[model samples]
Target: MNRFGKGLLVAALVGVVGMAFRVSWNALRDVATATGADETAAFLYPFVVDGLMALALVATLVLTGDARRFALRVLAAYTLASLVLNYVHGLVPQLHDEVVDWGRLADWDPANWALVLLATSLPVGSIYFGSDLVAKVLHHRPIETPTTTPNQDESAETYVNRSTADLGVSAPAPITPAPAAVALPAGPGVSLVKSTDRVPVGAVAAESTRPRRATGRVPEAARSSRPVRTAEELLIEARKVTADWSDRELTAEGIRKAVHTSPAKARVLRDTLRAERAAAREASKQAARAAGPGEAAA
Candidate 1:
């Protein structure tokens, strides 16, 4: 989800958790008071609190894809077991001690011990919290190699050296010199695109006279770098050319027809497009250098 949606969802969850906490606390307090239990004993309510909390956390994290599904499943199962135990204990209080001796048809129940262990030990919560902390630490930790074979390391180095040699490169290779910059040709037949400044009159006129090609041809590097009509200016020229033919909808074919060319040739004209872009970049850089210190500061 986008940022706003995520924020709204988190806010809703926080509200739900806050409401659940208040409701659970009041219910627990009422139960303790009726049993004549010490109010201080309510401090141990977190174990039970955790049971419900685990269930909520498991459900929320699972739906949101925030936590591992396996961990959430474990929490969910534990919470379900706790819920069943509470229900069983409340419905059949005698079952809390009714352990049957099959041979004698007699019983010794130990369910009360189970309830005490569940409440005091907080086994599920302890495991869940510990696992979560460990997971976080492991997630951020740089993983170390679990095993190392000397031969594998040697082979890796050998492969690197071999690849460099095959490419006619030396290990720890030397840097190469950059190519010389070409000057952009100027005058009546040249166009330049300077994004940082207003379009020039010379560029506009050059673009108007430049012919559109009709087929694809890989432009020679020299020609590719040669200054030609700029695209923005070319589009303006095209707009003027099409003004007479504007009654019809224009397509690639329509534009080609107006230019008396094919789509393949138009692709070749892109070399001129590249040249214009390059010239524009050069112009912008020059403009930047020419700006006064105060202008740059501003």
Candidate 2:
């Protein structure tokens, strides 16, 4: 509920408790006087009755799950009971001997006026106390702290290494260096040779001089005449070409011109780029799904 509604409920409860206290005190005092009880007993009688009432209220609060509704019902019942008892007591001949006119405020004695004010305030007091009690009881929870040992001071790296060792992870192999490229002689008619073949000095192996089969098919060795570019090399070239081109200029023609390759190869590079992007997106989605539950628990 809103703050204003809660305030009103509190005020009403306070009034009810006050009225019950007044009624309990008056009843006890009358009984004590009739039995010739001493001054101390008379003074402490109301507290006993109020304590019992408090215990009864707490018992009711604990037993019921819906405390707000229970408190409201208690406040209403007590207010009605107090009103009925007040009406009945006013009818008694002995009680009416010094009755004041409630309608005439100026004619009312100060003591009598104070009694009336206290009686009116009882319901408000009852509502406030009842609602407050229920709120405290229902919302209260015990706090839990993590248990730890004084001797436990392990670092994260130690834990990770231990876990990996237990899982039987093998040591990584040492990396080997790649062989250096062969340098060709720098002169007229001295051409660069493919890595797979050896050419003698002062010999010119022209492309047109290469022999072809009777079936007009090139030999496997002849097919590897030009060095084949690796996937990494193709991807690097594609990236450089895309970086230089605007969004509107990213067509097959632009890619061919930028990378100095044919249209078919440019198309192949674009398809590879799209496949890599799709794989990256899938990996990100899988990572998010894996971490979702852990994040929510935290």
The 0-to-1 C-alpha lDDT of every candidate, in the order given, reads 0.52, 0.58
Top candidate on TM-score is 1
Compared with the true structure, model 2 gives a TM-score of: 0.27
For model 2, the stretches where C-alpha displacement exceeds 4 angstroms are 59-166, 170-298
lDDT tens digits by residue: candidate 2, 1-298: 9999999999999999899788767754433332344577655644543543464366464554555456546545554545443443444434333242332222346844554444444445555665566565667454566575444545556567656655564434433434555785679977665554553445443333223335577778767566677767877978876865544566677677877777898888777666666797899999999999999999
lDDT of 2: 0.58
TM-score of each: 0.32, 0.27
Whole-model lDDT, candidate 1? 0.52
| Winning candidate number (lDDT) | 2
Cα-based lDDT at residue 136, candidate 2: 59
Each model's Cα RMSD = 26.2, 27.3
